[model samples]
Target: MQVFPYSIVAIFFIHHAVGLSFGSIFNDLKDTFSYYSSSLISEQCDKRWIPENITGLEDDLEKYLHGQDLAAEIIISALRSHLKKTYRKKPLVFTLHGWMGGGKGYTADFILKNWFLKGGRSKFVRKYFARKGYTADFILKNWFLKGGRSKFVRKYFARK
Candidate 1:
């Protein structure tokens, strides 16, 4: 009779062990399936985080702009305001006449340093939004380089 009680205890132990092992296996399988369907890797990309390198608005366009959000907001606002008041259409050949050093370049650097989510051309970046209707404005013409050297102008500066 004592031996019979020991057999029952052994059966209870076996049942608990089998139930726990099976439950764990089922849970693991469920997790693996969920990971793939969620467009993420299970072990590889669990704790994904965005790097601190975006720049557009000092506030909005967070993912696309990777720098000082406030500066971009001011610049974009200023550019829009300037364009709104005296917007005009001119030929491709014009002058940056008085203004130089190119905030456009600095702007591009700022954007590139802060925003680039993926690989792309400059136009696809911050400039192309106005590039279509305003290509004639501010005089930054796109030029092809011959052997990647000559900056595509038909005439060179007098000193050069």
Candidate 2:
């Protein structure tokens, strides 16, 4: 019958479409599970470093440099306010602008060491230094522009 041929074609098309959709659904589930698991592990590994006396932080910072009391005060105040907040807020972007040998990097080190348990070695902090090979264009195109981790990036970067 003519109807038999049409039914067979329709069934074949539907079966292939359903199979493709299920494959995509499986991949989606896998990605979601991996993302959540990694996030949970990250949260659990975050070890906090809270000094016994808060005043010690200021004293420790003073040991390295001289005549930056105003800058130190501002930084301390900002840190205090950040610590007091319970919920997550927007990320704090700090731009330590100064000439070479002006103690910008030193100040950053001191801040991180006092603020976190592992200090500069903490996993939470990602330091990206501008050097000869890692030019701005490379970062803009490959790192920032790519946004998040994807198959294309993983392949390009030679990562898993």
Candidate 3:
């Protein structure tokens, strides 16, 4: 007669004791591994930057932003084209310039709400403004002149 190893004997007894066949045990392990691997992949990936609703964004831009039809259309088209790529060499940057009451900030806020999962409250999104004490001159002198744009560009647009 052939002698069975301790592990083989233990496995045999455990299999019978647990009412599970070798195939079932292997299948269970495979399922568990698959679940854990997928969870790990999701955790490691950063997908917050992807826009969630492009069509809704386009519609909202058109409906809410009065007298800015061309701007809305251009923004939607540019965003759609940029986001369709599998790999991006650089982040898409939009410079919204107009009169003080031209709804630039409103448009930005709207886009942010539609793009991010947490909308404007997302931790990945940062908003810098020239508030009460911080005037435009102060910001220009401190931030724009002192390589702040470079730092901002590196953090958001550059490859890690």
Candidate that would win on TM-score: 3
Candidate 1's residue-wise lDDT over 23-66, tens digit each?
Answer: 66555556545655563322121213111143243334444445
Better of 1 and 2 by TM-score: 2
Candidate 2, residues 29-133: lDDT per residue as tens digits? 566567556744553232223231346568777777676777788877876776576663454456665666676667777766666555666544445555356
Q: What is the lDDT of residue 97 in candidate 2?
A: 58
TM-score of each candidate? 0.22, 0.51, 0.55
The candidate maximizing lDDT is 3
C-alpha displacement of 39 in model 1, angstroms? 10
The all-Cα superposition gives candidate 3 an RMSD in Å to the true structure of: 12.8
Superposed by TM-score, candidate 3 places the C-alpha of residue 26 at a distance from the truth, in angstroms, of: 11
Residue 123 displacement (Å), model 1:
8.3
Off by over 4 Å in 1: 1-73, 76-98, 118-123, 126-160
Ranking 1 against 2 by lDDT, winner = 2
lDDT of 1: 0.36
Between candidates 2 and 3, the one scoring higher on lDDT is: 3
- Model 3, 41-160: lDDT tens digits are 442213434345788898789789999888898889888897788777786777776777788778877777777655666544556653257567865775567665543321221110
Note the clash tally of each candidate. 13, 0, 0
